[model samples]
Target: MGDYFIKALACGDSLRVITTVTTETVREAQTRHRTWPTATAALGRTLTATMMMAAQQKGDEKITVTIQGGGPIGAIVADANTSGQVRGYVTNPEVHFDLNAQGKLDVARAVGNAGFLSVVKDLGLRENFTGRVPIISGELGDDFTYYFARSEQVPSAVGVGVLVNPDESVKAAGGFIIQVLPGADDAVIEKLENRLKEIPPISKLIDAGHSPEQLLDDLFADHDYRVLQKHSAEFYCDCSKEKFGDSIAGLGTKEIQAMIDEDGGAEVTCQFCETHYQFTADELKALMH
Candidate 1:
């Protein structure tokens, strides 16, 4: 189907699982960023995982995820809201490499083995929540799991994946995050760990046309879980000319004057969605006031 995710409570409500299918969203991102295969996989996985984390909040709360490895891809950035609005970009989208040993995208090499994954959550509170963790694997899913356990103190399992076509189109993109609560028993954790191992890569399932709901069913077929909510996700960027104009005004009167006198205009392209906003010399002059 389109992009969507299901949040569920399993193992007698002692575990939380979020399964998301983001094929369409990933495809849109590749188109906007013109990402190569490895770059697409790296950025797509980050986007999917960030979307799942954003679903943890409510109202106007938002989440921003930054993956800044020392690789050629530079940084992968994504921001999402509880309502499923998401926008992201890779600093270098043209990086590519041969497949890994498993004949899979070499995301780790493209995203690098060094650096940190930082997540900031704007919970509409006086102080936002920020979590930082070392990058165990540039595969992204494992790194997120580590972040939850070590940084956020939540024992979680994240399994994000993305597949690309020969033409660099996004074939599939999806993932799941499972967290054990304090009440979780050893048996419950063991069962989940075993199930996770037996399950195929999340991207494979998505390529096989599995929906988020179906994925949950397959993963926890024996467990009695309740669906908490479902969110429709999409590639949405709300950038505008006025927003960029205001930013230009914030650059002070001299800078605005420089754009008017030297360049005769100002053109700002959004890094997230690549939306271009152009202001004529007259418009730049107007902002001087």
Candidate 2:
């Protein structure tokens, strides 16, 4: 299936929910980054969460999520816009670890227990909005749930999971976010909480052929959920040779000449997508003009 996400409201609009299927998107990221199984799980979870959060924005608005856990996987940064475009990178994609005690990817060990998760929103305003909170759980989902309850002051539940194949490719990846809107009744919150406690992990559900709509149905149970919007999501990077050429041009004539004298050319690689752009001696000379 293609990558997609949905936004919905349940229980008379007292709850806001977002769910996504990101297996293809995560596979794209794994191929671009060549991430190990553990690294794939960590980065995939964060990317999925970022897409859901970005869906809350308006026109031309975007959101960036940073996970700086001070662990071997280093930092993960991702940006997503309302248009469903997303790009991200891990500071150390080669990192890996054995499964944890629960027979799951050891994301906490790879992400560490220190540092914070920061979020910045670009709303096309004079000043961008930013919020941050300590990384209470390096598992990502709990960290985002903590972020919403503490930083955004919204009671929310977040579930992000990524399953890795035997060959280290992404098998299933997905997530869900459910928030309690204002004036939600105590019974509604209690029942929803109870239901959440019984559902399987998000990755397991996706592996079982559950769509984003079905995930929401599982979350909301018998309550009717009205789908607000549906968007196709993907692992998209906005890096191009022309953009790299401009950056090389900005380095001035001296830098370009040095490259010609020392290495005979310049090779630029995008950190986000691992795409390489090469400029030969002739190309460099033309760029100097």
The list of candidate 2 runs beyond 4 A from truth reads none
What overall lDDT goes with each candidate model? 0.92, 0.92
Highest TM-score: give the candidate number.
Answer: 1
Per-residue lDDT of model 1, residues 58-165, tens digit only: 889999999987889999999999987788999999999999999999999988868999999998999999988888888898999999999889999999999999
What is the total number of backbone clashes in candidate 1? Answer: 0
Question: So what's the TM-score on candidate 2?
Answer: 0.96
lDDT of 2 by residue, 4-115 (tens): 9999999889999999999998899999999999999999999999998998889999999999989999999999999777878899898888789999999998888699
Show where candidate 1 strays beyond 4 Å. Answer: none
